[model samples]
Target: MARADGPRTANGPRTGGGPRADGPGTGDEGPVGGSGRRFAPWLPGVLIVGGVAFDLSTPPPYTAAPFLAAAPLIAAPLHPLRLTALAGALAVAAACLLAEFHGVRDWAQSATEIATVVTVALLALLINRIVRRGSKRLASARGIAEAAQRAVLPVPPARLAGLDVAARYVAAERDAAIGGDLYAVQDTPHGVRMVIGDVRGKGLGSVEVVAIVIGAFREAAEQEATLEGLTLRLERALQRERARRADIEQAEGFITAVLAEIPRGDSQLRMINRGHPAPLLLDGEGAVRQADPEVPALPLGMGDLGAWPDRVEELPFAEGVTLLLFTDGVSEARDAQGTFYDPAVRLRGRRFAGPVELLDALVADVERHTGGGTADDMALLALRRAPVAPGVDRGR
Candidate 1:
């Protein structure tokens, strides 16, 4: 596949969830947690007051110094610098008051207790500053990563050509915005062509392959006359990428992908599967069918192992029907009992108004199956052919 250097343009509005654009770790906002986050600011005061009560109730041999020392430390990461300083001062004051209440019979012991509190308080202030600095740095890094993900996988338009479309990318790691899974859809001269694939690995290496695959697909989708040709183009792009990266070649990296095309004014869809999960088709009557390949082919980037001509299969794609494509993340997702999530089974009799509704239901079902967590990232694409209106011309 030839390398595409020119920038690509999106056909419609982008729709998908990604990293928080508002940013994280802001001082005004409480740290991430449950109900405890709401009460975090009060914890230091509670600790200080509890320490005084413990000191008074406990035998003189057992000092509450440890409890007092913990106050400011607890406040450091959760509260503002001023609040942390106030917590430190409160802890020190409590320590001194306790020391005086117990009497100054041992001046050395009293002085040592007070000194420890003071030292701990000072350390807490330093820690507060360091934590704030680190939070800011983390926020900056997250912003850059989000930007990179958007650039690599620009969100597909909600509508492409005459079909209603929706795409989603869900990363396994909470902090990650992108992963090995990728999807792209574009309007071409032949029809609306799209691709969804999963690179072998994860992290930056996988992201690089994602970029290459998408770049090649965008260019090939417009130029290639057949789905097989587009698949070959993507295969060559990965091959070229592997040749340049020694590590990828050594690892024998490959991408499981499916190339799809819907010719203009046609009621059929053509697809070429390359060792990837078969896509699901939902007709207007709420019937589901798996668009499995007649002849299985190896995934792209494995041409070195064996080579065969790509085969494009045609499937019925009538009006009001939706096609759903996704990576292994969805099919392989396991519940606590190790049961895999079967989309076909879950959506067999469920009818949806549009592609967006279909995908929304599918994603929600997958999250429920996996208990809101999965071992791999997921990329989903749904396309629906709009039904013809009464007395309207079929041809545009």
Candidate 2:
């Protein structure tokens, strides 16, 4: 079956208001105010007032010096440098007032406390400068990660060969935008080919593997006519990558992936699984089942461990049916009580309008299950066969 053609690529750099692969954010909101930002305007006031009350209620030796000193340091990261300086001035002024009220202005302890406040206020200003510099560096790092993510996993076109498609990726580390999880979709001579996989390990090494696998897939998906042939190409690609790295990575590296093909004008889907989690097959009635492989297989890059022929599992891909693919991050997400999330159980009996809706709901459900924090990178792809429009030709 040949690919049904229109626009082959949908997810790219946003142009003329097209959907963005990286989502929308200007990166302007920093450690400053939202709810926490609101507290900044009054935090120094509360600290100063509390300190004054403490000094007044206690003896001369019992000073609010510590609170007076802390006020400015606390404000440094949450407010502008000017505001931080103002906070320090308020703390110092509060200390002076307390010293006068207690009639201890001439005492050595009072003088010591005044000097401490002044010195700390100056130190707080320095801390503020350091923090601002770090924030700028952090923002730059985030920008680089975002760019790498977009390049490694360009967004799948929203519509591919008449299928409604959407993909989402969530990195385990919130600030780290890219990780080992990967997905790719391409219109090839055979069909609309797609792959979702997770590389073992983390950090720059895993990201490097992700880039290599994706680059290989985009090139080989067009040439390999059979799913088995495509799987072999990927295996060789990873093995070659491992050979260039140190012996430790070569010994430890492996990837679990599922490659799939949806042919035009056919109600059948072909898949090759390499020890990855099974893709979920969802029907319009909201029933869900795992598209488990007919034969078990080892993960890619582990060819030396064992030799087995890669098998292709063909399944029904009926109208209004959706295929859901994901990495282990979705399955292994744990709740506070130490319970692992099972997507099969959670998605049963739940109907979605389309692939985009299913992903939004699934991601939200996982967040609620794991209390909004997952320890592994997540990559998800949903492809659905749109119901044929009335009076439209069944065979194109």
Candidate 3:
């Protein structure tokens, strides 16, 4: 069931377009304005000063009530309860002082103006309380999501089966900690087996598929004797999930994945690619090569469409060489100008101390290329064959 590559293409560098307004760098400091400055914290003070100046310069007919009312509103979301209260108090005091300075001949009008200021100030405090409560709820929700993500995709050990391993999962959506992207590595009697995949959808649905795929892989990696058999196990798992759910959408969804096996004491690794981005091989000499599948196969869960024999391709995985497997998020990442990021081309001449360094650099490079505006979740896994010492035994 071989199919052509997806429509996304990797081309030249980005041509034009400024950085995204919501791109990385704007942290809890405050919201960024059009001028790209953190002016939220100072806005209330500026408004108060401006209101005072306007009242002093203008006649009593032209009141600065609008400016005075806006000061507390501006501070509501950006400042704490105490600061917000202070801002409201200051605005009310300014209104009273201005009214007194004008020598109010109309007591009703003066009372109305002061009353309006007090009312707005009270509303601002209410807004501040609501915003703070919502923020606390959001923070608590994020903490729970992070914990779930860790449990679902627990970090692979730094060393596994004599190989240095590292993995990373980056979600494109700011509020999401986990999505359809997933990866798992396990040391089995067969050797170190790794799987990286991207499910077809997003949100909780995709997360369900991710959990199914990974759960199947962990169990199969221990029992399956070959990469081909292991791939079948994953396909069956997804098939069962769809059958159990009995939903048309779940039935239609598929997962693009790569299964890799590194036999103990062997200098080569075997891989079975199921319509996924080809893995990259980086050698000690800082040269990179792509391990594209000899024959493409449809992604898993698409067995209903067609079936083909899974082909296991062997590649050199000698000492000081690192193998990188990733989801389409990395390969399909586009810049402001729509040029897809090509990891092989970008990492061609880069040398890293180990798998951890390699993945860190790749993640940073992808963020830079996309200007931190990736539209999908990314999952990356890299494993390096540790260099053997002069008299060290290579046997497990």
Regions of model 3 farther than 4 Å from truth = 1-30, 33-38, 58-61, 393-396
Candidate 2 achieves a global lDDT of 0.82
How far residue 340's Cα lies from its native spot in candidate 3, in Å, is: 1.7
Clashing pairs in 3: none
Q: Output the number of the lDDT-best candidate.
A: 3
Q: Model 1: number of clashes?
A: 0
Which consecutive 10 residues in model 3 have the weakest lDDT in total? 1-10
Which should have the higher TM-score, number 2 or number 3? 3
| lDDT string, candidate 3, 108-163, tens digits | 66677778889999999999999999999999999999998988899999988788
- Alpha-carbon RMSD to native, per candidate: 15.4, 16.7, 13.1
lDDT of 3: 0.83
TM-scores of all candidate predictions against the true structure: 0.85, 0.85, 0.86
Q: Report the poorest 10 consecutive residues by lDDT, candidate 1.
A: 1-10
Instruction: Kindly give the number of clashing pairs for every candidate.
Output: 0, 1, 0
TM-score of 1: 0.85
Give lDDT tens digits, candidate 1, residues 129-204: 9999999999998999899888888777887777899988888999888889999888888998889999888667
Q: After superposition, how far is residue 131 of candidate 2 from its true place, in Å?
A: 1.0
